[model samples]
Target: MVDATIGQGGHSYLFGRALGPQGVVIGFDVDEKAMEKAEERLKTLKCRVILVHSNFSQIADELNNQGIKGADFILADLGVSSPQLGASEFGLSFLEDMPLDMRIDKRIQRSAADIIKYLDEKSLADLIYQYGEDRASRRIARFIVQSRKDFPITTTGRLANVVCRALGNRGKGRSRIHPATRTFQALRIAVNDELENLKALLDSAPEVLKRGGRIAVISFHSLEDRLVKYNFRKNKEENVYEIITKKPLIPTRQEISENRRCRSAKLRIARKISEGD
Candidate 1:
């Protein structure tokens, strides 16, 4: 089994407990802190645990290097963990001010601040619209550009303020979420190259799984869910996969009540198929 986004080993620990001593669970995470925490959490499990401090996009290569031919199961939880969002170093939240560094992996050269500082107005607007699905991207970009001219937008609070000011009262009264939410999400995605990394992982899945092996992906937003949906559907058409969920399985009301952040989660599963099957 492989846990692709093994955030704090919550999923891995549960799965590891069910595995026999001979069973192996290889986990991948780009965040070194997550890997360290996961190692501590999974240490008591009976199964052999191998934690890799790297992106899931490199799963195939890592597995091969470990002399693993194929895996029986692969699981990816695409949502950012609550701890990650709250960690001041990640700079993922607008609720409190933090340095505007949204890179999940510190190895990445560019931060959210770099993107904001360097990207042109039109490009910034396009990035927000394409990645965030924000309709007010132009106004936000204009405001950001104008604000930066006065002083560099170096922190999360300042960026949020700029976005809120751009949309005025409409940002507060009409929306349940903060006005800066979409803009921040856009910047985070860009800083991490998230969509492309997801594409790489999806593309590598069929080759990495053993025959009849299954893969499950839990995505938190429409962009991530849509990618998973289309990839599974396309693989099914090619007889490379058998879609397990006819429609995405969403979180139950009970589950959402227990963990409000999971309300937007959508889980999809698929099994690999060969010519004989």
Candidate 2:
């Protein structure tokens, strides 16, 4: 068993509980804080737990280093942890006035601040347009570049304000979500290389799973869901895997009503087929 994105040990604890005497579950988390908390939480569990402070994209390589060929089950939940958003220093939420630094791993050299400081107006605009699917991306990018010329756009609130101003009044639709929503998502994805890592993980998963092993992925946005859907469908075409969920399984309406953040989550599951099949 593997809990990929073991944020604060919520999923890791669940996996640990399911594991019996013969079961071994390894958890992966990029955040040091998450690892520390998960380690403590699973310490009293009956199952054997080995927590690694690393990206889930490296799960296969990590297991290989330990001479473990494959896993029976894997789960990846792709959403920023609550702590990451709640912390002002993380700059994950535009509501905060903290520095625009959204690095999941402290070791990563590049950051949201670095992209803002270096990317040209058009390049920045394209990133938001392509990655975030924001229609006002150009306006936002132009405003950001212009603002940075006179005063460096350092904080989340400052950037959010600029974006809102560029988009005109906070209309009813705009009020539904924060005006800076797309910009923050774009910056975070760029800072963490989220999509690319997921793609890499999808490409490597089949090789790291035994026959009939399950791979479940929970994605929060369209870009991620698209990648997961495409990979699952593509692998099914090659007869290497079977898609368990033809349509993505989403959270219940009740779940969404209770936790607004889970509203956008889409889960897909696939099982590896026999190599000779």
Candidate 3:
């Protein structure tokens, strides 16, 4: 089994409990802090645990390096973990006003602040539109460009303020969510190269999984969900996989009430198919 996004090893811990001494659970994560915490949490598990401080996109290569030919199960929960979001160093949330550095992996060369400081207005707008699915990307971009001319937008609070000013009063009272949510999400996705990494992981799963092995992905946003959905459908059509969830399984109301962050999660599962099947 593989926990592709083993944030703090919550899922891995539960799965590891069911595995015996011979079973192996390989967990992958880009965040060093997360890996550390996961290592601590999974220490007592009966199964052999191998934690990799790398992105799940490299699963195939990493597994090969470890002499693993194929895995029986892979689970990827794509949502940013709560601890990560709340960590000031990550700058993932606009709600608390942190430095505009959204690199989940410190190895990344550029931060969200660097992107805001350097990217041209048009490209910025396109990135927000493409990644965030926000309709007011142009206006937001214009505001960001214009504001940066006066002073650099160097913090999450300042960026959020700029976005709010761009939308004016509509951003404050009319929306159910904070106005800066989409903009922050756009920056985080860009900084992390999240979508591309997800694509890589999806492409490699079939090759890394044993015949009849299953892969499950939990995506938080529509962009991620769409990619998972289409990829599963394509693999199914090619007879490489059997889609386990015809429609994504969403969290129950009770579950959402317990953990609000999971409200938007969509889970999709697929099983690798043998030629004979």
Candidate 4:
């Protein structure tokens, strides 16, 4: 079993428990802080396991180095983790007043700060609209570019507030969802190259799966879901895999009512084709 995005080892520990002694569990996360926390959490789990500090996008090479031919189960949960969002210097949440840094891995040189500074206004607007699906991307981009004329936009809260001013038209109260949600998402996606990384991960998954092995992906956004959908369909058409979930498995109403974050999550699965079909 491979638990990609093993943030805080929640799912990894579960996999470790499920696998027992007969199976091995491999988990990967790019954040060292998360690695430490997850390692601590999984210390008592009784299973043969290896925790890797690397991006799951490089799973093929990492698994190869670990002498794993292919895993029977692969789980990739694509979204920023709560730890990354809540307890980190790298700003991921608009609610937080922190530096504009949003790189999931500290190794990555580019940051949300760097992206906004370097990317042209057109590119910035496009990024917000495409990745963020932001309705007021143009207004937000214009405001950001103009604001930098006074001083560089350096903090997440400051930027969020700016986006809110530019886009929000309040009668009684603030928006149901913060006006900054889309802007923050756009910045994070650009900082991490998330869409490209997701594409690469999906492209490489089939090759790293043993025959009849299953791969599960949980995507939180439309961009990711579309890529997963297209790639899974393409692979199945090529006879490389079979779609395990004809339709994505969305959270139950009860689950969504309890955890609002899980509302947007779409879980899809596919199995590598058995030898000789």
- Measured by lDDT, the strongest candidate is 3
Model 3 agreement with the true structure over 1-277: per-residue lDDT tens digits: 9999999999999999998888999999999999999999999999999999998899999999999988999999996899999999998888888998999999999999999999999999999999888899999999999999999999999999999999898787766889998998998899999999999999999999999899999999999999999999999999999999989999999999999999999999999996432
Write the residue-wise lDDT of candidate 2 on 80-195 in tens digits: 98788988767787877888889988999987878988999999999999888898898889999998898888788888888888887742365577888888888888889999
Model 2 weakest 10-residue run by lDDT: 168-177
Per-model lDDT:
0.92, 0.86, 0.93, 0.85
Better of 3 and 4 by lDDT: 3
Count of clashes, each model: 0, 0, 0, 0
TM-score for model 4?
Answer: 0.94
For every candidate in turn, the CA RMSD to the true structure comes to 1.4, 1.6, 1.4, 2.1
Error of 1 at 160 (Å): 0.7
Candidate 2 global CA lDDT score: 0.86
Residue 231 local lDDT, model 1: 99
Give the per-residue lDDT digits (tens) of candidate 4, residues 1-277: 9988888899888888887878788888888888888889988878877989988889899999999897899899997886678854877777878888998888999889888777778888999999899867888899888888888888887788788778758411544767788788888888888888888888878878889999999999888999999999999899898998999999999999998889889999999995632
Per-prediction TM-score: 0.97, 0.96, 0.97, 0.94
Q: In model 2, state the lDDT of residue 25.
A: 81
The superposed Cα distance between candidate 1 and the true structure at residue 187, in angstroms, equals: 0.7
lDDT accuracy of residue 60 in candidate 1 = 93
Order the candidate numbers by lDDT, best to worst: 3, 1, 2, 4
